[model samples]
Target: MRFFRRLMLCVAPALLGVAASEPLSESFDVSVPQLPQIVATDGGKAVRYELHLTNFATVPLAVRGILVTDADTGKILRSFSRRPLLTHLIPLSGTRDDPSSARVTIQPGARAVLYVELSGPLPRRIGHTVDYVAACETCPLRLEIPAVAVNQAAAVTLAPPLAAGPWAAVQSPDWPRGHRRVVYTLDGKARIPGRYAIDWVGLDDAGRTTRGDPDRAVDAIGYDAPVLAGADARVAAVRDGMVESASIARNPDHVLGDGSGNYVALDLGQGRYAFYEHLRPGSIQVKVGQRVRRGQAIGALGFSGDTTGPHLHLHVANGLDPLKAEGIPFVIDSYTEIGRYDDIGALGSKPWQSAGPTRKSHEWPASNVVVRFR
Candidate 1:
């Protein structure tokens, strides 16, 4: 009920006008049980408690810090605060802030969940509360969740499956010469936020990649896109309401937190997930719980979400939660590495290396050369 009350407060006109006029700050709502209860697991051990934070502000707000303390002693029990992603894509005009600093901006009326995990030996009594303090530009806001004790098994669930494919091998014969060639160039730099791989893929009639200009082949080439299930075991989630937006680089959605305009997340077995972000919104064709064939046409490509242009943001990770998940390396079946930066090594072949001389030239590989996967 506290979360509900906070949600109402966020949309109130007075708060809305202030948030719209000034730089926003951090706030939170707690949904845990009202009465503090003791949680028992493994017959007598303390259960792990997960905390989720919901943002209801108009501008983005960063979660600068989180502190969990013993109510009786006022002693801090745990704390967590840091930017999770290695590479971040800032708007060309936006100010550059500290990387470890909480720079999260929850779009107006939108919601993003921040998670915290707490595990411990059993506490003997109830009536304790966990206090959380978070901040942005101005001052910090405090929230408290009443602790509860319960004897229940934690539920484990699998994430969606990786997009399947009649994967196409597109050619990038004229890829720019450099260690960062595969990376999208923003402000003349290659390291962008989120882990991704780039390669050329021939598009079929049903594929959106074909719509790109071919003569501007370097810009025209499309990735070997895959269609993934939104949830594990079958299709479990689908949203078909949003329409795709035209490609626009670095345009932040003033209306929403970099709207992942529309997307499908498949729950792969075992808490793993595959996220197909920025799919043409409203193009979703699959239904909840419907089993889909591999490489099925779930939707077309679009420029949505926290993106500047129309490039797919692809990754495989341990969970559906972006902030808490670890990005893992993955590969498509096959493609040719038509060219290489003599000074930099192979394309789509290595973790981003920042220490070496940047490559400046490349020659197309032989027509029949097989592209190796990393």
Candidate 2:
């Protein structure tokens, strides 16, 4: 699959056939990869798609609302405003009231992602054509998407791609809707719909991250810690020598240019790939085209690339390129639930409550829940 930097806008010839000008005409563009038709676990017909929104103007654009409807019947299937039940089916970053209260802003030349879900047992007939309207302050845009044919093949089941180890989940999908950091991405492609992804960091008994010092990249815990291969795999890609961004306000060009700095991409057979990002400069031990086994050390964790601090950013996707692939769910072999923090901001000082049990089978650790490996 190819990655797109920006979407192209094509106006229907019927709309005066003239190229749309600034303000509403050519200010933004939207595209959907494919409309996946599937039967939800609830036995309802489901359609899941992600909208890639790009702003072409020089100033920021405030997105007021989004409305989706059946093009033939004009029946509104979902709206960010009226239908709370159906609209809630999609995992949007902000609250329901956000559209009118405080709309989402799209920075100049930046992109935004909106995952939408339409499901119900009643609508036995799926609409072949879907229409959507995007409400913004300066101009409103509408799109008519021709639904692609459905793929009847069964969904692929996923397995854990990591070794058993004590780790803390950060910006994880398991977190509360608004608090989930993985939902936001710089390129608008990292937030894959229906798939679980997470950022991990190591921790000690004192709640302090194992390695690095705050504000100082080198002093941070987990710095230079060994990064183990989650499963037997072939090195699909490797990148190194990218400079680290020490502060939260990173250089946009570097951050967006080389997202997974000094990293490794492992193809674990099938179509799944394990991505380990932000490794220490010159610390990568595996090269592209190399073969590795489960639990093998591939590299040392570092603060390299578009990171504010040192930590291991790992995710399993359907393809080798993380940002362009679909994120998939997986479980670690085994781990003990240690404790969880009440407030992540008070990381080093917060007292953790003892966890209840341990799991030996495949399962995802709860957000902010601490876990230890045997």
Candidate 3:
């Protein structure tokens, strides 16, 4: 907390006019590895980031809640607590299964991470107010940590990989398993390559993901759909001849470290690369060093890698390796939002409730929304 308190000397307190007698605040440490980046969403703007916390106190402490506020104005923007907070908090050290308590409770010398996603408009600077239940009587209940500046950098805008389809923009806010939470370590460095990733699962006219036999790859609506180049760039990496998953029930873990089966990485320049993963066997048309135009067919969507069904796993990253790189935000040039699915289990069978074909430009579709790229 000494480090945190020293950094926030110029920032406003969480409770204005109320001095925070942070007696025990100096016993703990908190930080953010990768700062929050503002991205345009279908509904509005959103900031997605994480908070890493370490406990130095001799006793255990339970995090009560977390509040996000405008740093300059001291206006409360969003708050999380109880079940909602527990769902996003993850214990990075010690045992995960403690029947008496949750993983959010930071044990002495243990570390944890808090996943946060704030929707709507926000200021350039933000502050965090964290409340904790400590064992010591001198420990203050609240600590205000500010100086977290929001990255207003514009997201890389690209063309849709699939030329035409009512694609279900599938994603979940669940941590420890969601694309946003999965991290990979390569060369002794960890990175989240799927931080802003999306699985483009195509839907048929009837709003079904597949027809005939669901287990067969040939029946999947997205199977063999032409995958296009998101931008005009040189091919940095290419992999092919990956055996497609015979059944939707198959797991690619047996293949080991081949999650991005038969993929292609395009160099988007400026330290950016676009990865198109889970492509059909022998469908990759470009080779390494080949420059492709936007909207050019690069491959076909197929059930490969760590997949349950046929879909295109597309994401932008800062490196060439699919797993080693850190994921970054990318916006579609133009797409029409048609409908949406609230539940993942009901994706194919349940028809999507239609909405006005909202023509969204230079923005990424929100999770579970249906968008048509034409």
Candidate 4:
């Protein structure tokens, strides 16, 4: 009888079909909204992009890790965890920020964005494996994003936006509320126009950002600095005749007109538009349909828009919509790396920490670094 029972157990799967199949439904819908773009950084190359995740399950799903890999070889490229992972995931809808709660969790039917920056040799395509656990479920789940194509389009190479330097190419390194993290959803589309933007904050001979105090707009070093054209192109758009504050405002809420104030947009050919923002009132020298030469003085930087002080906000985008266009990367033709800083206060404290004055070409200056553009 025991032998007969054993035989029945062995043949049960074939005779009565007792074998189980894994569930085919996914817990989350994963997509890459844009192709990851490649930039030639000082250290090899970096892929910059984002992933949009939407919860598919009825309950919440707490994201644990996101693993990026080479699509062809399946080789691991970059992985994120802990605090790094927490800060990168931004919930787009229906979630309150709680310090104690796991910030990576996406509620049912809610969506979140994961900003990813991976560095290495350029991959033909990238893949992703996202680990998460659903509420009211025992087992963890993984969502796979297979074969996202890398954007092969080369970064636009351009001349320096200013004729002089010892200028600080100020792109914030922080992920929290920096230009790189702002994903503006407007007109039914989402894009980050300042992903590669830099605030060209000029400095004086004594290595000071301001001559007197930061409160006075004219005292700021970046004020009245000539905003130069990065390319020989047509003046696509210009916003002029905006009033400026005599004193600097400290982190005030941004309101009024696209937050750019008086500005000039250059059509740099190939559908790329270069923007120079926050010009001094009545300083914009060019108008729409005018031709501009490379290094031409288009305007002067000032505190005309939402700003902590006077500075030129320069960026290249795919469209004319400053808020809705996807920001693209560009490299200055030549510049000397002076050093870096954590904040504006760190500059001129002790000679910029010395980057050895090495001339770098066809490379974008890193965040908060001092550079003398040639």
Candidate 5:
């Protein structure tokens, strides 16, 4: 009987159909922030996840396929073959090739980033699990994402920071943070942060962004625009004295200290911080520790930081430091979706079409959609 028990123990795993050998690096790492990082936006019409994939081998790993499915029901949520999956890796930090490039190769010790967004109407809570199959030559991986890890609750709702006027949600969270990278901070410390940051630009008639020539700082319409407090809050921190660059080229060295150049951070209670960045030097009106009210003028928008031009770089995060904190989502009480902008064409020449005059409330504008505040 003792011999029979030992044999059963040995055959138990096989009876349960366990694999005899693991993949080359089946233990390869997949990093995600604490669970329930899932966020809902566009009035809960969308759900997003920022996933990081790391390859810890010496040879290059090519991500050739992907599959996202409902774990319980075996329903396929999303799937990508080699061709489409390659596009997903195009925006990763290291890859420089066009989307037409067939395969995205991850260099040894590098990460392959992916931004996953599932359109709603979705459940308030996922209540199940998601199965992920990332097919690769050297790092093929399969894992499950818990439903509890994704929170579909409403993001923060707040009053519009700027007074009534035309402004462009030039770079907004309506989509992934950058054209591809989902998290707000360039540094990986932030998890699902800055998911909804907005780089706002005010526009004028004649489809011109500035008053004069495009290259001149003074010609930009966003220059000197009044940046207001989005809510009643206390000043948390301030950074000033960084000179605005003469042109739109970003100086990589300044990203750490002056990237947000001459900015104001407001504590909006409940541990939420409102960041108003890229302000003109000496234009800040409130000092740290000062109490401020909604609609109070804080500073003029400027080109002082790591920016393409003069625009309000606004976002909310969990902590005081923008670089370290995870980005949180918020909604403007109301704004009118006025038009769309052509980013590749001459600056500000994008045509404005009537999304109609009707004003929409409790809305979050997507990236590149022009809107008016009233």
Candidate 6:
């Protein structure tokens, strides 16, 4: 009996099975919704859609693939899966999770969001569906998403304006801070896999100071905030479960360089991808092969990588490869023109934030305008 008991203990993991080889029966609560009107000029137009998936069981589960098809012809339109550049897993908390592992696990009652967009002339007709293979510790299962169409468009106005204020320069040693004189030119175009700016509630404020204060106001600001989808696209890469850093202060333990903490990369189609980095641990809200819409709630911001304070760092890149991708130029919808560090004309300017004062002299925008097309 003693020997049998020991053998059972040794075989427990095998009996329970590993995620890779096991199949389970899983139920999903899923939905598809039409998006608001999206305007474009010339030959460009925008169509938006969203997919929300929730796990109803207590055990962990995995979703392997999702596909979109045209309901009229039963022909496949777009395909999404666990690809290197087009798959992601988000937690119920709306945070991005890491995808390096073999399986995606969602706790009981957890939810994930998938936003999808098709740009260019609106399709004559469209329908969307998902293909998912999920498993628990002991069983594996497969699911086919209910087909839905992208036939409706709603009216939507531009977003609200940002706050206005005087631009105050914060000085940093190696990082670009306040303003400096540099000759730079904008790219004639923007590409997928691009990077952009993430404005923190407190860090990017025109009048706020993030340095050299005992109060550490910058540290006081929480790292987690809603991260909107920069562009319309299907869900791409998502990396979660990385531990969130407590503060941006230099830590000797971080010397080895772990890339952005938890992150989400969205494929804007046409070889363009947008990456949101330094996400809070376990805050992801989407899954692999899922679709996402622009300005949708994806995840919260956090300081998890090479950062000194809780500020969002956004830039555009060209390729899906994070290491090899090149940064691109992008414009926010709106921003105020505040005072400059070295320019007297910009001094005491109300409700503006200057990009810098050294290279070019420009005023920030006022608070009431939405940052559009920038």
Each prediction's TM-score versus the true structure: 0.35, 0.59, 0.89, 0.89, 0.79, 0.39
Candidates 3 and 6, the one with greater TM-score: 3
Once fitted onto the true fold, the runs of candidate 4 whose alpha carbons sit more than 4 angstroms away are 1-18, 94-103, 205-207, 250-256, 342-345, 348-351
Model 3, 162-201: lDDT tens per residue?
9778899988667368799876767896567888999999
lDDT of 3: 0.81
The whole-model lDDT of each prediction reads 0.38, 0.57, 0.81, 0.77, 0.63, 0.44
The alpha-carbon RMSD values of the candidates against the true structure, listed in the order shown, are 15.8, 8.9, 4.6, 7.5, 6.6, 19.6
Per residue, candidate 5 scores C-alpha lDDT tens digits across 85-111 of: 664543345554345645566666777
Better-scoring candidate (lDDT), 3 or 4: 3
What digit string (tens of lDDT, one per residue) describes model 4 on residues 1-374? 00000112122344556674333334667767667788776646776788888876687778878888898999998776666677777788746446454448888889888888877686888887887776535566666666788888889888888866788877763556778888888889778888889988878756678878767889887788888888889999999887887767654555745488789999988889988998999998988999999998999988887877788898889999678799998888888887777565767444565666777888877878888866
For candidate 1, give the lDDT of residue 230: 30
lDDT of 6 by residue, 175-208 (tens): 2221111112224421122212233333334333
lDDT score at residue 47, model 5, on the 0-100 scale = 53
Query: lDDT, candidate 4, residue 86?
Result: 71
* Superposed model 5: Cα runs more than 4 Å off: 1-27, 34-44, 57-61, 70-74, 90-103, 124-142, 145-148, 172-193, 246-255, 342-347
Better of 1 and 5 by TM-score: 5
- Relative to the true structure, candidate 2 reaches a TM of 0.59
Top lDDT prediction, candidate number: 3
Number of clashes recorded per candidate: 35, 8, 1, 0, 9, 56
Query: Compared with the true structure, what per-residue lDDT tens digits does model 1 show for residues 142-191?
Result: 44454434434222221222232212222221233311112223344222
